[model samples]
Target: MSAKVQWFAKDLLIIGAGFAAAMHIGKLPAAIPILQAELGLSLVQSGLLLSCIQCAGICFALLIGSYVSKLGLKRCVLLGLSLLTLASICAGLTQSVLSLFSMRIIEGFGFLLVTLSGPALIRELAPIQSLPAKMGLWAAYMGGGVGIALITAPMLIQSWSWSVVWFSYALITLSFLIGIAWFIPNTTPSSQAVPLKSLIKLTLQHQPAWLLALIFGTYAGQWFASVGFLPTIYEQNHIAPTLAGLLTASVSIANAVGTFICGLLLQRGLQAKLLVILGFVVLIACALLFYTAKDSLPFMLQYVLVFGFSLFGGLVAGSIFAQALHFAPSPMAISTTVGMILQCSALSQFLLPPSIALLVSSTGTWLWVGVLMSVLSILGIVLTQRLFAIQPKTSA
Candidate 1:
């Protein structure tokens, strides 16, 4: 294919896969609670169900990067999506905790394949000029996927069993798998992959890559911290639990709006670093508005906090991922570069939000968490600026 044609085709293909992944992840909250209640699972067990997937994703990051030639991005994605579809169905039908745990591991492995290779393929197909613009669009799609999933999960659960929600999400994966199998080209390398240790060393040494990871981790931590408390805050203030879930869906979908807007901005010639800094600013504003205005404001404006928080939040999420991958041009090491950043980001996503909740308990308020977000977000902006100033052109 011509470079131009390949760029368009590859991006569409990647976005399609992202759409499927987003739907499944978005549905997690509604569906998991059912399984938890049904199985009488402890809090730790419930967390592991999610972490099991993260763990699988971690291992697949290295294995996929280290073996893309043998497995091929197309094959891996299709295989993973197929497994995801099956796993979703199996997860719905699981009769016991053990069976559910086994199914979650399968879902984890499948998700890892799809997530790691999707961006690597985009990096391969993008022309040098399109890096910033194309990446923005890619990020928008990921954020969009999250919105669609979260919004739909509640509606599905209201009318149908949570099991049906999983099965329905499976249909999304199945459709994506079929589309990918037919349209997306095989993207495996012909040569053996770089050694795992060497790939790690290369990415760790790449300043821009590591910086992007920190930026991603920082904003992701802040965003997750806000989002984690959003539902509970609403509930504590007397909003119905179901209403809180819907509110979560609203904020999540708003994140998609933020992503699409940022992507369009990048396409229109905005600088990536400027956008990253702007996102941090938005997050800080969101934090202050939510935390500082207890009774002064009317109910409606204060309630809009969720939308405001997620409104421009995704600008940070997708930009950093794209930037991290763009810092390296080697197809041989692209997987490792993306993997390392994602792994770090995933850690923050898992750890930081809970820590903030603990702060609320120990400190007797959400003030410390709010302060932590502001400080970290500021640091992220600083790092983004430094990286941009040092490596302006190539580190898109």
Candidate 2:
């Protein structure tokens, strides 16, 4: 195949991987309640499912970060999709949290494989000048998949059962795996493969990478804490229980829109630092409205506040990921850096939901949750904008 044709083929395969990953985010909400009730699990137990996904990512990213240059993208993605299929089916069949954890060990690694290679794959398939734009679209589509899953999964579970949720996601994984097997182009010329040796570099160990990791992690923790518990909160408020599905799903859609906007602006010379700064600004506004004005606001406005806050919040999740790819020391190192960032984000995903649940279980109001979001947002802003003179740009 011609170089252009080969690159486009590989791009499609990468896109399929992203679609599969995005769907996993949507699958969690529906699974949480079912797992809690089915296995007599606590909110903490449910939170670990997310933890497993990130855990695998963290470990694998370090081991395999630069492996793309050696193993090639097609082989790595094939392995992940196969594992993803197995994990989804296993998670669907398992009756206990123990079984779920066992299966998630597989799922988490699969996710890591997919994510760590994402930016590297894009770089291989697209021109150097198009990296930001391509990564942005990739982020949008991935976020959109999460949105689609959020909207669809709840209604299915409402009518069916929790097992159906996992099975359904399994189907998505299976289909994507097949597509990837059929169409992902072979690995093209590698730019620079980041070696594990450089991981020992003190400058990387110290400043920009870790600090940026924390910023992403904190922002994600606050956002997930809110999203993970939203269903229960909806139930508590006696609003439509489906509102959780609608809201989470819609926010995903909004996030996609935001990411897309960011991609467009980035192409026009928008700064990554500015986007991070603006994200915190929006999060602060959301916290104030969510805390102080929440009760007084009408239902529509409530939706608007949640949606608006989440739109930018979701943007942070995707765009930061894209940025990680951008700053990657080399193609081979994509997994290492992206894995670290995802690990931090995933740690936040693991910890915050249970923390918020415990607090709310004791305190009985979302008031303090708002305070948490505000604080995290401020911290993220400080950390992201620190030392780096360029302002992080926001997606739309």
Each model's TM-score, in the order given?
0.89, 0.84
Candidate 1: 10-residue stretch with minimal lDDT: 387-396
lDDT of 1 by residue, 1-396 (tens): 876786687677777787787666666766667766778877888877766666664445654555553567677678778888999999888778888788878877777677777776776667767665666666655456666766777788779878888888898889888877876666755466566666667666777767776787787666666666666667557887776776777777677677767767776777777888888898887677766664465556766865776777778875676666657535566666666666766678778877887887898876666678788888988888887776423433
RMSD from true fold, candidate 1: 2.9
Off by over 4 Å in 2: 1-9, 32-44, 58-60, 64-69, 93-97, 155-164, 188-206, 358-365, 390-396
Clashing pairs in 1: none
Largest lDDT belongs to which candidate? Answer: 1
* Residues 7-123, model 2: lDDT tens digits: 666676687677777687567766677777778889767666656666765555555654555677767777777787888888888786788888878877777777667766676
